[model samples]
Target chain A: MTLALYVPRQSAVHRVPAGGKLLALAVLAVVLFAVPTLPVAAAGLLGVLLVGLGAARLPAASLARQARTVRWWLAGLFVFHALFSDLPTAAVTVLRLLALVLAAAVVTATTRVTEMVAVIEWLCAPLRVFGVRPARIGLVIAMALRFIPVLAERADRIREAQAARGGSARGLRGVRTTVTPLLVQLLQMAHTISEALDARGADDEPPARGRRSPVTAA
Target chain B: MKTKDLAYIALFAAIIAVLGTLPAVNIGPVPITAQTLGVMLAGGVLGARRGFLAVLLFLVLVAIGLPLLSSGAGGLAVFAGATAGYLYSWPVAAFVIGWLTERVWSRYTVVWGVLINVLGGMVVIYLIGVPVLAAVANLSLWEAIVSGAWPFLPGDAAKAFIAAAIADQVRRSYPVIERPQRELAGR
Candidate 1:
């Protein structure tokens, strides 16, 4: 599954550092919610489009697909608001959400996953005082990203195998049969992977010396 | 934590993502997904702390702008959106499930597991999810309860029961959660 939204491109938007892009996204979200007006929402929507399609040089289809994915939600949100509130309010809410969504798409499409992880590490650095290992967290995130496709494939295989075996599994029995085997496979892989990780020094890293580091510096 | 513990957490996080890839029914921003089953499984299989961390890790990845959430929903936008309350409730729900599961580890049964999941995965989620839905979407509490959560009750219950039964099978076959500290003390 090409699950990542990143689209490799060499443009000004892509050139923006991951942290900067993420910060801009945060600000856009705040401004939209803090002042929910039709003009502001419309501007935000247009601005995201210009940056994503014009400056970022991202394929229009890529962003369009994202909008399509949430089309139902968008429609429902709009209808609910219009019925409950008013047309102007509905337009403001919808535009605000659409702009935020597009801006986020631009950010994800422009930045690499590793770069995003680095930003998360920086954000979590403050937690180091509580003995949290940001690197370990990064490793877990990377591992999860790497393995999602693998697990999805395994799930497919399990369904296929069940199909081959007379297709009797249905409802609760079917779900149980599928999930039990899938989880068992994951657990077995975890056993071997842990051994590999230990050999690869995943556990040997020095602990975060939150308490001792200050003393040592003194 | 041991290397194996870290791997379990990461793998469980991956499991959540994989489950999200299953077909979803979208009504509002929050879709009906098998993803919460993975959340229940995490707590049931990894116990409290690790289960919480696994779900948290998956959510952080979503927040990192990966399209890991069901229906390709991810990023700070989703977190800031109306459905953000449900997302916020996930880790806590997983934690509560694991905490309850660990307490009943010795006498665990499919029935017990299902009850735990329903309480944590459904009840707890609705507790936080409805209020946030109301506040963010600017609907009344009754409107939020009627629109945001009511549509989700049956599907969530099915998922809760399925997750519990799956946890029971995993426990009997290839249990991942270690004996809790309390269990060790009692023994």
Candidate 2:
């Protein structure tokens, strides 16, 4: 349920402003994907690894853990390209993907969720001029981030409960059975949350523009 | 927006992200993921606007480098990759699904739910994803079709069915579909 990639540490990567890190990540991604060649990808990979390990002070395992999920994809990508195209193209593609993932890992590991939310809110503040409530938007995003782990845990519980009932979520039927109960519970949870928010007057719109009606003023 | 609407938006976005954490079903280039099911549910249960907002929120986070996508990949870099078209189609997919659901709410049935999900979630998404993938990866359209759409048809059908079943059942029980007060008053 936890954000497995994030490990709190005091280092230069962690100290960098979230906006700056995000900007750097964007630039890094553009450069890697734009001119993707084997040597260029290799250089990008090395650069990301150096920043991840040295600047972020993240353990090698953290990087490995993030890469672990994509290990099969990398292999599959290579095979697909080798058969369809050539080894160099495959290698370059894999390297580019790895470099991007590693760079992302560094950013996520260093930046706290709250800091990320704040940065998002700050970035979206300009939309307030168009009657968009950046604060509300930010809060919704923050809430979503916070609930991800909780719901994931809930899913685990649902699966375990199904297992206890001698049900294995194996094939198509199993998926239906497992998903039905999970969605029911999730919807129920949503209803309860909305009710609680309503009880707290969350739906109450503020007084409109602080303007008195002409009739009332007269 | 009401707090309840905000709550729904946030919860559905979280649900999508949670689904992303599930182990991806590795296909050749694009992986089969539960996140699309989350997208369907967001639309079917939350109605169109909220569903769109929820997905947009998730995408914004992903754009900011959140590793919330399947296989822990995120950031603007992904926008340049082969799967970017699929990623970009999600919000529109959710919106279409939700909009259809909202329009058919009074006469909703499981059949309609399945149809809507398939139409919006699978067909709509594939419409956008295949060509973009071909362009990005420099493959022929036929090759892109082979890689992007053909392999996942059965699984996606099942996902659409399940998403519809759950959404329909939830609607039957909770009835969270938003109706404007003026519409209700007119009725």
Candidate 3:
């Protein structure tokens, strides 16, 4: 199964209110868009990095792993920008993107999925006046979060099986072969999960009643 | 809801987040991201209403500036870009996908489910996304499709099939959640 990506950390970042973190992320994104210089963007990125280090108390090693995953995309963005735009502009764009990404990564690494859902549920409370069901919405968020790792695990198993069967999915062709089976497996898994939900009285629940309350206590 | 159900939702959301973080394959204007897979699965497995809600939750995170999108792209500005159509179409796509799966393909085998899910989800997305993209990017309909929608087709199709197959398997192993009895009877 695709394991949950949340690194278990009892750090300041994790403890910070989800609302605050979300607000900060929004502000940072805006600044990145408004700022137009490489040096400035780079400084912004560095600032974010420093905050991440302090808030998440992320070990240097974990930071490296995160960087490694992003390296290819960063390189690709750099190359694309260099080819299409001026060098300085390209650098700034790339740095801006990186800063945004790293900041997000820090949030994900520290925040638990349940905490996110709680925050979402809280935020959607105002919609109750519009006849929205916060609890139902919360349920949906919860389910999607559950399915990711399950689907990932199934995908991994299928890939391994394909490999065992001598499937040479090493390049573009590999993507095709690998994706086809993965798709097939994903469908099957979804069906299984749906059935499980049905069997578990999923249908018995009444349709969300009266305008959903805006804030459901998590 | 039971704790298990709560757990399932939490798990799927995490999946969506992690998948978003993965490196994207930049085919062109629209980079291939894994959020679509999450979108499809959310609908197919959770049914229309719940699936829509899940996508909304994810989008809320994005709106608040979480870099939950592919390539660490998030924030309100991301919503104003050329790719906004695809991003915004997610909830609608998930609702359509779940509705179709429950209505048309509930009893079908993995292959049939995959086919319907892929076609259904893609059509809805393109229908909404292509037009919005054309308007935003100041491209003609055809040009928007070519630049914004075309590159993602093959990848999305793959995701659809994957979602269908996995959903089908999950149904077979646990037959209880397949569909409402009334719906099944109509089929």
TM-score of chain A of each: 0.71, 0.75, 0.72
* Per-residue lDDT over A1-218 for candidate 1, one digit per residue giving the tens place of the 0 to 100 score: 43357999889988888999988876777677778889999999999999999999999999897687557766876787798789998899778777876887788789887887788788888998998887777767767776776887777777788779877576887767665876788888987988998898988876555756666878
The alpha-carbon lDDT assigned to residue B129 of candidate 2 equals 95
| Candidate 3 lDDT over residue span A53-102, tens digit each | 87677776665665666677778778877887778877887889878777
Off by over 4 Å in 2: A4-9, A34-46, A58-102, A160-167, A171-177, A190-218, B23-29, B138-147, B179-187
Ranking by TM-score: 2, 1, 3
Give the TM-score of each candidate: 0.76, 0.79, 0.71
Q: Name the candidate, 1 or 3, with the larger TM-score value.
A: 1
Worst 10 residues of 3 chain B by lDDT: B1-10
**Per-residue accuracy of model 2 over A24-61 as CA lDDT, tens digit each:** 98887778767978899999999999999987789999
lDDT of each: 0.82, 0.82, 0.69
Model 3: how many Å of interface RMSD? 6.3
Off by over 4 Å in 1: A3-15, A24-112, A157-169, A207-218, B28-30, B181-187
Please give the distance, in angstroms, between residue A207's alpha carbon in candidate 2 and its true position after superposition. Answer: 12
Put the candidates in DockQ order, highest first: 2, 1, 3
Model 3 over residues B1-187: C-alpha lDDT tens digits? Answer: 4434444444445457667755678765678887788788777766676667567767765786655688677888778777788778888988887787777544667676676666657887788888888988799999988987788877887877777766665555443234678875887
Task: Tell me the alpha-carbon RMSD of every candidate.
Answer: 5.4, 5.7, 6.4
Candidate 2 true-interface contact recovery: 0.66
